[model samples]
Target: MTTTTATYDPGLIDMTNEANKKIKVLLELRPALDGFAGIPQEVRLLFRGLRKIESVDIEGLLQTSHRRLARGTSDTGFFRKKISAARRYNRISNVIISMAEKPYRNVLDIIMDYFQKRAEVASLQISMVSGFGKIKLTRFESKSFEDFTWRTIFSKTLPASDFSLVAPANHRVCSVPWHTLHTVGLSTLNWRSTPKYPKLDTKGFDIFIGQTPYPARVDPDTAYVIRYHDAIPIFMPHTISDKSLHQATHFYAMMSNVKSGAWFACVSEATRQDLIRIFPEVTDRAVTIHNMVAHHYFLENSAFERVPGIIRSRLYEGDPSKGIELLPKFFSLREKENFYKRSLGDKHFKYLLIVSTIEPRKNHTRLLAAWEVLKADVDPDLKLVVVGTLGWEHSSITKAFSSWIDRGDLFMLNAVPAPDLRVLYRHAAATVCPSLGEGFDFSGVESMASGGITIASDIPVHREVYEDAAEYFDPYATMSLVKALKKVLYEEGAQQEQEQMRQRGGEVSSRYLPEQIIPQWERFAERVVAERKSIKSSTTTVFEEKNSSVSST
Candidate 1:
């Protein structure tokens, strides 16, 4: 045999490295036949898709994931062909690496060996990716920054680097933002690591970021950018989920892995300050990257113009009379009444809106207490619309407010879609976020963007973000909220104040537009890339087992 070699572009070498990593990742994803034994084939397919899987036949990629998952794979030849294709794709002239030529056992070992030294990748920096490791490994999915809507919005407005993705934002509110990525032509890269180690072979990440804390464990060669979304879980233990303590412990354990010059994407200045106050070592690296509002809000939707009442009713009533298209046949007269009655009730009335999950930290109970005091004296017909989903540690909240909900004075719309939410925010007299703590509150911004007055808690983040644009009140004291509520609801010239606040909403919230946040993200990514080039990956980097201990900053 002649010493054979084929010349190829450096890009092929990069592609080969990525292929090896992908193949190694697939090996770990072969669903255990134990519980999956009796499950439907559709379920198997769903899991496979989520695990970043592809079909053996190129045609299979075109099929609906559910259909493919339902059919399952029967051809052993397909697996052989799939592996062969990846190896073929990896081929380049004069390259010594050959997964195809090796024995199966050697191939597995070779792939494992490559991943073991993932830091020796083509790129200058290794960006750590987080695939909800905290939730996946622990089965603890209590509402956190990883579960926030900002994750979905960030993907659309900003170019995703290493760690941001919601996978499937099925909710209407999330659908537009998630799909916006495709319009922008950016793929959500996988952030998951194999059982061996993270696959940082080709296309080394400049910076790895997740909505939660994920320390890239290989060493100082990689920059492990932690999402310091909030410090409430550490401080307000009573307000967190039962498994949150376990999650926090896991988060802190990964802090030791941040030696390679960590950075932070702070949600607000107040959050940045809190981070610095707690971890002085990170003061230099922390940056205030405010969670942004979607451009759609400012462009075509409710930012400036209120919807025409005739058109709004036509859409709601399914009449199609205002030059709108025909409604689905299933949409009936009775359903329209149900939609209106459930949301707005039989009697149309303006209501105060509170958009937050039903949890202890939201201060809904305090708001309710204020409502009770205010309702007894004035505005008997005033309604309180609370929009959000049920959260943990909320039994007492439901118990206390159950009667109010029953009496119809308090209306709760859980997981209201974006269109309906826009309407609510558009028409609501005011929107309030009385949370005890937050990384960056969206309720006030979302509502304020829709020309609604905002009243938030006296929390530092609220002050920093709202800054006189919103009225503030003590969330702890019942009367404090009552007094503030009365001044806004009953006080004279309050309409003028709301109009003024509406103008300020457009002004203040401009800071959170995609135009604003996108540049920050670009600048941040540039800095990370430049920083990576400036400092080479240190040779003495430490690679250790997943130890569960929080390292001091």
Candidate 2:
């Protein structure tokens, strides 16, 4: 007998078992192309965390949701030609669709609409399967891709000072836009009981993980996983930007993913419960593995003097003259100068912070109302700082903010990098998360991680994620938030309670670090692979037994 000992590599997981091959994962990279926050931030963090696990070899699948990628194109000419062609086709299709929808549509118009629908199906098929088997994959060493990689990976955190280059080794582009494939699949939903999903040629990949519910199907041999965020568009349609299309896309894609045996890795228990509420059968397949907080947000000592500079430097540029009419009657240059001077050195210079987009669902107006009351009664020196880019339906919020902004009492900042945001978090009187809904609100945990106090809406996710680390208030009631703010930020004899919350926060936030979360992902992947193997083994055994019985007969 010969004995063989397998030496393990310390960097990766020990693979001494029968199946020694590394699990290959193709992670969708579409979300990372957007702004450096929300889903994009989570996608980037997942990529970075997955890279550190030795048991898995992961590559990025580059496919835009709304933009078509050209096939067999050089790096320089990837989407330009396809986009122009798509736009031209869209114009013609729109004309036909408009004619068909009109009350006085003629036979000619009806014929054209039928042909147009046929042409769309044909185009969708071509886009989906064209050159799928031998599709050429581009590497990620290109300057543009490298820049994109770094921006995505380090968006929510400060990169190491000594860090130079970091990117995935392999990346493949899919010619069909995700939306096209999704919509084509959705065309079947009206007639079929179970909507037929468009198929993706997932040839060699062992696993395909999408950031949301994908509208395409993978091979039965491959496991498809969704990093499910939330079903906001389904439940709270009024809050989202595009009610009809967004809700349909999310609900239909989710239905397809569910029917196709796709596993879900939700960011919170609350999110997982939402999934189960829709499809009870998928309860076994869905699991909760919380999001990873950036490594940049540990407790740090920083001066309050830096806040003004950070805000000014990152201020979201708006039409300075458009809101001039809304400027206060008492607005004066002296007070503005005095505000800056006091922010630089005054001991009483404190600001209330809200880090979210200027959107209705974020409940910015409610927070603003509460802040106004606090300013008038609690502390006149208290300023309000809002940090986020402009989201849809923000005209009213911006309008409400115009007078305060002109008076230098309100600041709107955007594109703040993680290091600067960390400083802001640490020095602020309190960071407020006043969202109407969320999968796992990042701001509150992030504030806690940065040694800052948090006041969040009294939502289920907040209770689950923030726990003892945050003060809670009713999202709908302005007075409730005002009362919570007083207790957390300004009430007498609350310093001891605040200090206790900070201590609890440090411990709570540590649960979301990469080192802690990555193991959960690894274990989930292993379990999925093990189940696949068990199914395969059972199928083979049944097939062999049937063959034996047939031969005897």
Candidate 3:
């Protein structure tokens, strides 16, 4: 084998020039492989193209080396041929210039630039769990009133006061503040194992915000803060095998990060109580912050439109129409038999809307059963539209939908688009969600925001979100739901009652606006930072005293 060296002017052979040369070589060499046509055309073309660029430059050399190995070149003679080609390519003065000015001068240098730029900004430092992908900060805008309330508190309040938002890469909710925090998008699945692990700056952040408690032996150097998103144990027990063990583990993990003095924020007073009950030692650390809904949702916007035709089609196609005939009974006017007629008649259907995943916890089965009984007894014009996906863990619960597949008085729609949902809420006679349990019922408040009367389960979270603006019902009592539905749907003065509730819902939802909640978050964060600093000083003093006593002994 012999190496070929071609010397050319250095300035003339840049990336573009080299690339053009490689292309010209490939075009010239294509006919040479035709004599041995046993190989596929693609394979032959690839082989010739790689050989043409083998002596061009570093990038070309690297690409050629990869191609030759992929083609199964085991012969020492063939290896020597490629190696000689690489040496010959380096000797080409033009090729040397092209390789010398590599695109990325130093990756580390670019990263350092990013760090320095960030240091100059009035930024929040936040770390998030990224298991699913980048945390979508924008999704917070569309969050249900419950989630939105918590989000506003964290993003506006906490960060303004210099608290750092940190969580596992998979933690979805906390990652919403990435834009403010200067953390990379939530999609990056990088987890830091130690305190100051990301180590952007050794001074360390003022406070660390986490949903789950930190593991034992966390770096003592950084202050740990915990915010309880929900009392999951109280509501989601059926979803877990052993509630006690889960609570115990959760309690242990949360306390491990407390370090004798740390601030804990909870979504509601009920959640704070539950946390203290489960972890008595951490009771002193907890503070209750009632969740809030954004004000815009509660305000009437003329720009808001009804559900789109395509989304409505996707949700209602092939689904049961059991309650179609009952529309006249629920509402005095039955304009049309199908959705098109109902949508076209008055532009707003004053009917009940139920938003929930089709599962047992949502009590869809009993709701359906009660609806069936009501349909048989009443005139039946009011419509019941069930929206949301069919989640798992409920075998008996899901059967009700299947049973009512052809019935005209009932309707089941899974996963309707948000715009349509908003429209549905605005036009609804009332929005009803009688869940067995809920961390914070989003549907009820959203319904209220849309100026619809809200009927919900008698849960503490619901009370906090709805206050006295919602009609409450017992989850197990089918008749209670039926009575509430009938009253809201058809009783005299029902419309007046509905309007009053809507007004109150609008008033209550204002507190959750970004402006109101953001400042509160700022104060909470400042307090957490101050408290953590005090605790650290005390711990240091105790450690020094113990060391002195041991040394004297």
| Top candidate (TM-score) | 2
Clashes of each: 2, 0, 36
Off by over 4 Å in 1: 1-203, 218-222, 299-348, 537-553
What's the TM-score of each model vs. the native? 0.58, 0.82, 0.55
Candidate 1, residue 456: CA error in Å? 0.4
- 1-553 in candidate 2: lDDT tens per residue? 1111111112333323246688888888788766767788888778777777788888777777665443222233323343354443343333223222433346975686567456546755553445122223333332334444455444444375413423524565665667887777677767666556666656667788988788777777778899999978878899989799888888888888898888898888888888888899988788888899988789988877788788768877764575523223347888756765654456547888888877999999999999999989978878888988778888999889987887678888888988899999998889999999998878888899999999999988888888878888999999999999999877887898789989999989998998888888887777776677778789999999999999999
Candidate 1 structure quality by residue, lDDT tens digits, 321-341: 634222223378897556445
- Compared to the true structure, candidate 2 yields what TM-score? 0.82
What is the per-residue lDDT of model 3 for residues 1-553, given as tens digits with 9 covering 90 to 100? 1111111112322222223332111011112222211111222222222222333210011111011111111123313444354333232322123223422325864675366345423122333331222211101111122232223222221222221211100111121121222223211224443221111121223444444342222134444555465556555766543566555445444544454344566655666666677667776667655444423245455432353342346444432364322122223234234644444344433356788766667777667766766666763555567776545554455455554544433555654544456667776667787877664556776677767678887777777667888888777888887788777666898777777878888766564445554444444444554555567789999999999999999
Query: Model 2 shows how many backbone clashes?
Result: 0
Cα error, residue 293 of model 3, in Å, equals 2.5
Question: Where does model 3 exceed 4 Å of error?
Answer: 1-203, 212-217, 234-236, 239-262, 294-296, 301-350, 408-417, 543-553
Better of 1 and 2 by TM-score: 2
lDDT value, candidate 1, whole model: 0.48
Root-mean-square deviation of Cα positions for candidate 3 versus the true structure, in angstroms? 22.8
